[model samples]
Target: MKIVVLNGSPDSRRFELDCYLAELEGLLETRGHVVKSFELRAMNIGHCTGCWGCWVKTPGECVIRDDSQKVCRAAINSDLLLFASPVIMGFTSAVLKKISDRLIPLLHPYFEIDRGEIHHRKRYERYPAVGLLLERATDTDEEDLELIRDIYARMALDFKSELKFTGLTGNPAEEAADALDRL
Candidate 1:
């Protein structure tokens, strides 16, 4: 499987997270999966303009020519998408949200009639399974976990992908790797 991990924490190379991700990458490689990682802090990704250009004017492309297009391409090419972030204010980091906003072009604009009922179209070509890793300090870990789960649930609905596994309050990278291994 080709896995694309997005490190959305502002602290791209933060010690614990980095170590975890490294371990996870090695484990995945050992399991015959290629991993590609994107650190949001290192990329010059602009906020989404909500221009709907990708849907209206251009198809499957964004107007803002930046790191987002690369990220989206990676997402499209990957079999699994891992979203790793440090909990901020009981939610995902703003960096993740920004990337997600730019990814709006990947989703359908309105509803599709699957069996006579209106439903959003599946966003990805294969509906790549998602793994969420939420890192936080000791006391607030549980709360942050719940908040993160809720956030991802909403995201899953929007993206029409399944939230396969969630790792919270543990070593970010290792826990995430373990979750992926279970998949």
Candidate 2:
């Protein structure tokens, strides 16, 4: 499988999340999966200003010319898109949220009924399946993880995909790799 990993750790010096991703990447490579990872903190990504340019002005691309374009491109082209982050203040880091917001361009402005609810129309024929890999905060609990998963699940639905895997840095890298393999 072709996988794109969006590393949302804000601090480059933090090795806990980084180390886990490294191990996971190695395992996936050994399994013959193509993996591409992005360190968001090291990239120049603009914050989504809530402007409807990507929807109205630009059909499937963001108006802002930044690293988010690269992220969007890789995500849309990959089979799996993994969002990795360390839980911060009960949520993912600000960097992750920013890039996640920028992904609005991947959907159309028109809405469609899905499961009796409204969701944006898909801009592309195929979107990558979503995954989450989180490093829990000291105060993080089951509720927090569930909340994050629920949010990502909704996001996957919005993207016309599914959240197929979720893992933690606390777990063995092989476990996460195996989960992804099953996908």
Candidate 3:
């Protein structure tokens, strides 16, 4: 399986998170799986302008010409995508949200009825399954985590993918890998 990780922590010196990701990468690689990761905070990704250029003018590609294209491409190509971010104000980091918003180009503009609701048409043949790896905030609670999970579950639906699991940074990397390995 090919996996891609989107790291959205803004701190440059994220020692524990960095080490955890490295461990996860190594575990996957040793199992003969390809793994790729992007530190979104360090990348030059711009916020989506909501112009619909990608859907209309560009046809399945963003016109911004930034690092987000690479992220989107990798994500679309992967079998699993793990979004790793620290909770900020009860949500994922803004950097992750920025790049995530940029992923709109991956879907078609036309809407289709899915599960009795309007949804964008899928542009690609396949999209990656998703997982969440979050570092809880100081004041985080169970309700906050549940809200985050529900939000990402909706995102998975929009992307035409499944959300496998949502784990926490406090968990050992081996445990997270084990959960993914089962999938």
The candidate scoring highest on TM-score is: 2
lDDT assessment of candidate 2: 0.95
Candidate 3 accuracy as TM-score: 0.97
Report the C-alpha lDDT of model 2 over 1-183, residue by residue, as the tens digit. Answer: 999999999998889999999999999999999999999999999898988899888878888999999999999999999999999989999989999999998899999999999999888999999999999999999999999999999999999999999999999999999999999
lDDT of 1 at 182: 69
- Lowest-sum lDDT 10-residue window in model 1: 168-177
Task: Report the C-alpha displacement of residue 74, candidate 2, in angstroms.
Answer: 0.5
- Which lDDT tens digits does candidate 1 get at residues 29-122? 9888899999888999999888988877887788889999999988877878889877777777899889988987787676787546566776
Clashing pairs in 2: none
Off by over 4 Å in 2: none
Worst 10 residues of 2 by lDDT: 55-64
Over the stretch 39-87, how does candidate 3's per-residue lDDT look in tens digits?
8888999999999999889899998998988998899999998999988
Specify the highest-lDDT model's number.
Answer: 2
lDDT scores of the candidates, listed in order: 0.78, 0.95, 0.90
Once model 2 is optimally superposed onto the true structure by TM-score, how far is the C-alpha of residue 76 displaced, in angstroms? 0.3
Q: What's the TM-score of each model vs. the native? A: 0.87, 0.98, 0.97
